[model samples]
Structures are given as C-alpha cells and as structure tokens.
Target: MTATGTTLVIGATGTTGSRTAARLMAGGHRVKAASRRATSIPGAEPVLFDWYDPATHAAALDGVDRVYLIPPVGESDPAVVMLPFLHRARTAGVQRAVLLSSSAIPEGGPAVGTVHQALPDLFQQWAVLRPSWFMQNFTDTHAHALSIREDGIIWTATDSGRVGFVDAEDIAAVAVHALTDEHAPNTDLVLTGPEALSYDDVATILTEVTGRPVVHRKLSYEQLRDRLTALVPVEFAAILAGLDRAIAEGAEDRLTDTVQRLIGRPARTLRALCEREMR
Candidate 1:
C-alpha cells in the first residue's frame, strides 16, 4: 500500500513470507520482518516474533499498520496462538491482514481455517490465500526433497490425483499484491499454477529435466501416516497424510486463474521449477 505505513510480515523467513517482504521492500514499502530467530533479511527490519510467546508480539507490532501471516508450522491447530496475537495486532493499529492458508482447508475447515473465518471481525481489510500444494516441497529441504535426493523417489498417498502445484514465488507475488494493493480482497483467494499435475507427472518431468531417475512411489493413507509420524508429531502426521488422501480423491484436481488475475501473468509450471531447482 503506497499510502500505508509499515507492514509486519509474520514468518518473514518462511516460504511465501520472505518473498512477500522482499517484494514490498523492493517496491519502496516499509517492512518489519518477523521471525523466531529474528534473522536478518536484506531491505527489511528484523524482529523477534513467535506465536507461542506473547512478550515478543508488542515490539513486532510497533509502527505497523498491516500484516502478512504465515501460521506456525507442524501444528495441526494454529488458531489458538494465532487468534490471540491477531487480536492484539488489531488493537495495535493493524488495519489490514493477509493470511497464508492451504487449498485443502476452507474458512472454518481446520487449522488456519479458524483464523480465516475470524479475519472479518478482527481487521476491516483482510484476505486469505488458500494456495494449492507448493512446488518447493519437491525441491527444498522437505521430506520429498530428501527422499528424492537419497532414494530417487517421490512418495505420496495421492494415486492418480492431479494438483495445481503452485510456485512459492508466485504465491508470494499474489501475497504482495494483496498486501500493497489499494483494496484488500476481503475474501479467500485459491491460487494455483497454470496447470494441474500429478506426482507421477512431476517425477517424469524431474527425470526429463534433471536426467535423474526419479519416480513416484504411491503409498496408502495409513502407510504414509505411519511413515510421517517418525518425521513430525503424530497428530500433524495424520493431518498431512489425510491431505494426501484427499488429493487421491480428486480434491486438489483443478486449476485457477487467481495468480493471473491478480498478478497479470501465467503461473509457473512444475517443469520450470524442476529445471531451476534440480538442474
């Protein structure tokens, strides 16, 4: 927002948050980059912020009029901590808030969904980003990335289900637009890439681009859940596994023009991501 004051970017070092903060700063906007370690980001004011800690909230909220929210990771339910800080944020003069949510979760569905539902009551200018699964999951230090590096395999419970795997950078562009635009969407925006693709299709593209032997190894819901329990909390593991199951049921099999409509550009493709990250 050109006329607005500083915008506090919660989870500033995280996936979409970091990119959003950078874009804002590049556009000559003030930003308070909120993170757990208060990591330094170029063109941003770093601030120590944690959802579990209330003492860190006040300092981060100082002199900020808007916020970009990235909910706590690995917690099946984040609304408990998020809602309180949001309430405090409203009192501290935050007029607009942009939330990062998932396509699988709707307003009042689960997890950040609760926060999505409460936005109207808290901030007059508020928008929720419900993006499809991120393409970075297959490239970054995520479990899929690690497995791809070690075993040359991509594991998932979604069998034959297609998803509009969006790029985090694209998601951030939409986020920046939502945060800085004159009018907040005041609604949930379901973002996706240009096309829908399945895990098998992803592996095929990876192999073609990177010249690596990557394959999609499909698993049952219970199997994936048990496997993920060793990596994350049991409850979160179940939730992640359940999302994969939903994908199998064609829940994520679609595409949207939100990215194009908001940013005036076609969403990036998984093949492009594979070429950049893998090759």
Candidate 2:
C-alpha cells in the first residue's frame, strides 16, 4: 500500500525516532519531528511536544494523520500520560500508530505494555514494536556503556542468560514499515538480531574489537536493584531488576525473524555494532 499525508514522529530526537523520521522523509513522506524541545531535523518540520502537557498535543497533531509513539522516558506508567493524547489523536482523524515498546513488556504486562493493549482497539492500523535489548546499550546512554568505557566491566543480573540484542536502527526500519506500509501489521512484532548471546559473549566481542580486557560482572537481583536505586525510584529499580530476573529465567534467549521478514534484510549483529562503535 502507498503512504500518504504527514506523519508525526514523537521523540524525533531519540535513537530510533530520529532514524525513522529521516527514513520517512527520504521516502518522500512529510514528517513532523515532535519532541519536548523544538529540535530541528533537516528536511522535516519540528514541533514542540511533550506527553505530560496536553496543550502541546494539538499543534503537533495538527495536519497529521499517522503518528509514531515513543512513550515518555522514566515514567513507570507511561499510559497515564500518553493515553489522553492518543484519544485526542484518534478524534482528530489520526489513523495509524506505531508504538516503540519492549520485548520484556508484554501487552497488559507493565510499562508500555498497557499502551500496547490499547493501540489495536484505538486504531485499526497500529503496530507495537517489541524490540529486545538494544545493541546500542553498550555504546549509548545506558549505564552498561559507561562501565564498559571506564572500568571495562558490564554489570548485570542476567548471569548466563542469553539475549538476541537488536540494533536501534533495525527497530527504526521496522517502525517505518509499520507506519508507512499500505496496511499496518495490526499486531505486536517481536524484533531481535540474528543470534542470542550472553553478557559474557558481549564482553568477549568488546574485548576482541576494542583490544581491551572487557568482562561481564554478574550480580544477584538484590545487588542489581541496590546499584540502580541511587539512579531511579526504588519501585522503578525493582521493575528493572525484575527484568533481569526474567532474563535469568531464560526469557530473552529466543530469536525472531520479524525484522528480516518486515525489512527484507537480516538484522545487524552484535559484532557489527561493536565494530562500528569501536571505530
């Protein structure tokens, strides 16, 4: 199906949102890059938007029918803030939506999961992109990246549990497809890289690529929660630690073809991402 009309890309300055906005613009679709700040993207319109502020919602949704939903960060329950805007969007004739959710958060589970459950009922053309841990976590804003850079250690509570880490770029590609395709996926897409690897395997890859001694420091759930508590709310820290506990139970060990099936190419591998970041 052919794509038409302007697409509002919320969190357009973010990792995946930026890429998706660029791809849509390159494909000849008009894009409105929405963020809390009026961050400009060349060749796309920029608008000030924040989920917590309903006043900013209308102008950003103006003249836009399709939206890429990136939930507000650090909020334990994003649905509370985003649902009202979504209701407004639907009422304003917005037809398609692609939400960036997480693999660990199933529909009706937690966090963005509540929004995932509501998307299908709100819009006939909607997709929830449930991606595994981002490969960029080792090079981006995440704490793991900081530890790797400073102490050459990757700390986690997953022990030997394996995860099919996906790249943010791959997730963006899938999001583009979901947003622009003639018909939306109308369901949740589990996105992951080609292979599953433990934190130890990731450290090994970092060692090989960076020519440094990188190691994985396995911590118990309690230890992990303690480490995170200083940075986030206790409840939120516990939620994050719970994901690691799920990981320990082998929750993220599986792989999926959703990326390749949707984008017609294999997802980027951990080695490739490491090599690129190292250089």
Candidate 3:
C-alpha cells in the first residue's frame, strides 16, 4: 500500500540506509533518519538511535508506521537487540518492515539470519533484502579500497571465484518498492548485478577505469582470518574469512533477476560504478 505515516530508517548514514532514506524523501515520503549522532539529512527528520541503548528505541518509534532495519554492524547475534526493537515497533503500529541482510545468510542461518527468521512473525507486511557483496567495497569504506589507493593491492581469501557484486543503489531501489508499493512483497529478495566477476576481473576493470595499477592478492582462509582478527573479534573474523572461502568455492558465482523485476531497471555493474566514482 502507499505509505501514510513516517518511516523510521535505522543506520540512516550507512551504505544502503542513506540511499534508501534519500529515495524516500525524493518520493515525498516522510522519514525519521535515525542515527546515533542524530545527523542531519537533506529532507528527513533526524533522530538519535543506538542499538545498544534501549532508551533510544521508544522515541524513534514515535509516529513511525514503517521501518527499514539495518542490524548492528559486526554483531554476530543481533537478534538480542533487534528482536526487542521489532516487538516494540509492532506494538507502536509499524505495519511494514524491511530488513537488510546478506545473500549468504539465509533466514535461519548465522549472524543477522536470526533477525531475518523472526521478522515475518513480527510484521505481516515484511521483506528481507539479501544482496550480494557490494560493488562499493572496492571504491569506498572497505579496507580493500584503502589498500588499492595506498598499496595498489586488494587482499582476499576468495581466489578466482566470481560474484555478482551489486551496487548499493540497486538494493535500495528494491527496498523502496518493498516498503511503499501497493502491496507488500512478503518474500526474501536475492539481489545481484547482471553478471559475475572474479576479483582478478575487478582489478582489470579498476586499472582500465581509473588508470591505476590494482592487483588482487589472495590469502589462505586461516591467514586471512588471522589478519582480520587484528581488526575485529576472532569469531567475527572467522565468519568474514569463511565467507571469502565460501566465495572461492563458487558460492557467490551466480546472478539474480530481482533488481530488474522490482526496480524495472538492470542492476548497476562494478565497472560502471567505478567509472562514475573515479571521474
């Protein structure tokens, strides 16, 4: 249904959240841009929200009829905090809920999967966005981007395997349809770009688009996990490293038509994104 009340966007400044919120505002949809610092957004109300703090939950829920959930980053068990907030939102009259989840994590798998499993029961009008690895990982915030800029290298355990690295914008577009369409799509969407490419292919594209030398450096799963442990918890590190290994085993070597079907446009490719960002 066409949305009537304000939609609460958690992690409003994050990769997909910011884009989703901006799209909502562009469509004249009311939005509460919820972030820890209550950061100002162009056309949405700012509200302070912290997953670890229950006090921020109630006020953020005020007058919110819809919610876009982005679980606490790096937390393996987000259901502990997520479930409680979802229950509160249900009581506060949130009719639709859209959750951002990973393509690798199924409804009942590990990590945010716990929250994915509980979302359907909490809101009858709900959808889970399971997008593949983001194309921005090479152009933005990720360590690989920093490495490419500084050392001309990209490290990963995923050797030679291809993935349909999708753009964050495509994920957000699908999310908007799920959130405000005439009828809620009560299903999980596996979003991906038009084709799969290996990191070697990515390095080639980067070199061509940016005129910079970029190389893919493959590491063993254990080595990558140990390297990541220096930056994140060992358990979470293992999970991240394991994902790379899974990719290497061809787990992510696939494409999906969800973006085209929902957004009515082909998903953006990594090369296209790189060319735009580099310019």
Please give, for residues 88-167, the per-residue lDDT of candidate 2 as tens digits.
99999999999999999999989899999999889989999999999989988789999999999999999999999999
lDDT tens digits, residue span 174-212, model 1: 998988899999999999999899999989888898887
By lDDT, the better pick of 1 and 2 is 2
Q: Which 10-residue window in model 1 sums to the lowest lDDT?
A: 1-10
Which regions of candidate 1 fall more than 4 Å away from where they truly are? none
**Candidate 2 — worst ten consecutive residues by lDDT sum?**
1-10
Candidate 3 Cα deviation (angstroms), residue 267: 0.7
- In order of appearance, the predictions have TM-scores of 0.98, 0.98, 0.98
Residue 125's lDDT in candidate 3: 96
The lDDT of each candidate is: 0.93, 0.93, 0.92
Candidate with top lDDT is 2
Residue 117 local lDDT, model 2: 91
Pairs that collide in candidate 1 are 1-180
Stretches of candidate 2 exceeding 4 Å from the true structure: none
Give the lDDT of residue 46 in candidate 3.
Answer: 98
lDDT of 1 at 31: 96
Task: Give the lowest summed-lDDT range of ten residues in model 3.
Answer: 1-10
